[model samples]
Target: MTTPAPTALQRPDGSPLRILVVDDEQMLTDLLSMALKMEGWEVRSAASGFEALSLAREFEPDAMVLDIMMPDLDGMSVLQRLRQSGDDVPVLFLTAKDSVGDRVAGLTAGGDDYVTKPFSLEEVVARLRGLMRRAGTATAGGADPVLRVGDLTLNEDSHEIERGGTSIELTATEFELLRYLMRNQRRVVSKAQILDRVWNYDFGGRSSVVELYISYLRKKIDAGREPLIHTVRGVGYMIKAPQ
Candidate 1:
């Protein structure tokens, strides 16, 4: 029996969400495209990183399923270039390398999620649905689409952030981390919570990834300014407006 489409797959306008599937393997790309289309989503596939980059600009997809081991330009390079160009589209990395370091590299390079190859199509679909929901929340229309703490401003709809009137570029992962911290400003958030919410992984006892991304955020959002991210010492991390 075919799985039913999740309600979250629909956009705010009631249109189907668009997804770009990128893989060097033609068979994998075709398989993913067919599966995503079954969920009533608009699916586009690219067999190489170059084509993926080009289609991403023109398609402006809501999310992307990217393969890590591509010839010429790999998935990490494609994602990094996209983040540099200020495209905050959510990306899920597919790879045969399931090591801890591999996952960390993908997340640090700005991917929102990761899936090992020989993965279940159901799991991939579920992960994509989760990503779509999170992205929707970030860009959801409301009376206030922007979050603020001190001089730092994050516009959810535009995926833009500014601090002290200076624009700050953030990768998709960085943006999500900052948003979570800003949402709970003044409240300490544990590393476990961050891993679950931001990375969508449960690394347990391996919370170094949180520290790394926090440092990345600090370099961009806190450097040369009054520090906003603070370690609670023996606890977690917190962000608050400067006194």
Candidate 2:
């Protein structure tokens, strides 16, 4: 038998990443915990949204896999509460509903990604890795540690951002999106490129996700300032210093 590939759950310094899996189903949580632990990650699970919220505060996981259709407090409520408390830990929603409306709702509600029911274990692992990476907690050390475009700055090491001498907070997904754009600086990146680089998913050619995030960045990064992010009509988007 061929040896299975290892799960990407360790930081560059060899520390195991912590992940919290929340679901009402015992078998599902158990299976997820087992698979996560097999990747050498610290795994925690909660059978209810209430327990999940409590554990989230205590565990402070690097990422969360949350089930939406839970009894009592639902995933949406849990996530909303966390956000209300200023917690921006990356979240991947697990739902039986795969409708566009459902996905949009989750994303709009601060979820980083989603996985439909009957997802492959490999796909879950991949999606979690992508979330961790975007959260800027996957790697320990790197060169250049910072990127700057005009007055806006992003420190990869600290996972902090500032614009025009003002500190700005960004969710994990937003940080990754801005980083990709600032890294490309003067180059206009197509929506397809942005999806591939930021989301690491084909998303079934759904370019609206990119548009939504760009609007988000605009409100956060460009509001009340000379816009650094520019739309290249009918093409994609670009970030560049003000002319």
lDDT for each candidate structure = 0.84, 0.84
The TM-score of predicted model 1 comes to: 0.58
> Where does candidate 2 stray beyond 4 Å?
1-7, 140-243
List TM-scores for all candidates, in order: 0.58, 0.58
- Which prediction has the highest TM-score against the true structure? 2
**List of clashing residue pairs for candidate 2:** none
Q: Where does model 1 exceed 4 Å of error?
A: 1-5, 137-199, 202-243
Candidate 2 per-residue lDDT, tens place, 100-144, comes to 678889988999988889887766876787688767768633345
- The CA lDDT at 81 in model 1 is 95
Which ten contiguous residues of candidate 2 have the minimum total lDDT?
1-10
